[model samples]
Target: MADETESGERGNVKTGGCLCGSVRYEVRGELRPVVNCHCSQCRKTHGHFIGYTSADRNDLVLAEESGLRWYQSSEKARRGFCHQCGASLFWEPTEGSSVAISAGTLDAPTGLKTVRHIFVAEKGDYYEIDDGLPQFPGTMRGHPLPEA
Candidate 1:
């Protein structure tokens, strides 16, 4: 696999559209730390554990929002989805500094590098996280790390 550093230096912009293609977005800046979230809510929302990445909201641009939907998942967090097809798109902290874009939503070759695993204790019993990334016992809410 190509390293994220090499891929990022190429400025290969990653773009994705909703399942129905009504909503589209482009991640234009360098991709940073990526994470796999195993929280119950995430698993329920995506029908599986979700992969996410931390990025400055400014780095994300909704090229089209005709089918976008925002759900306030909690007092401090909200999740964006495709209203037309109910495809989960991204998660953002209501007051934090960054956004967590669904890694699977991005078109392949996004230069995203997985650096950690979260909500391990709450993870579904059906799958195992085999990646060597750091595992946190729960959600990463107030840590000094980036949004993912």
Candidate 2:
């Protein structure tokens, strides 16, 4: 994913799910551009770097969660995944500040792009961050996410 620009909010609606369709969700309103996360926890959860776009807690709605399970990764954060398919679905702050939805799980034509990379300092040595986007050693909120 590369950086791409989009216009005003379209009140767009997006739907996504786990590989086994056990966890489905709907996100309304505008979504932030994709941010590639290189933190160790993210890499372990998704089996690699995790690509995600975010939205307010109010905008993300889980339509189905029969197979959804949340793992409290740390004191301040927890990760959501499908118990059946073991697909990573979300990363959210324990305070419910916002939710990070996996970009790959989103339905096509999301009109989203990779705006930057986060936690670059912890990135694995197996891959290189060749993308020219800004690489931050912290979270997007820590660096203030760039414009789309």
For each candidate in turn, the TM-score is: 0.83, 0.88
Segments in model 1 whose C-alpha atoms lie over 4 Å from true places: 1-12, 140-148
lDDT value, residue 82 of candidate 2:
96
Stretches off by above 4 angstroms in model 2 are 1-11
Worst 10 residues of 2 by lDDT: 1-10
Point out the worst 10-residue segment of candidate 1 by lDDT: 1-10
Per-residue lDDT for 40 in model 1?
95
Model 1 clash count equals 0
Q: What is the C-alpha lDDT of each candidate?
A: 0.80, 0.84
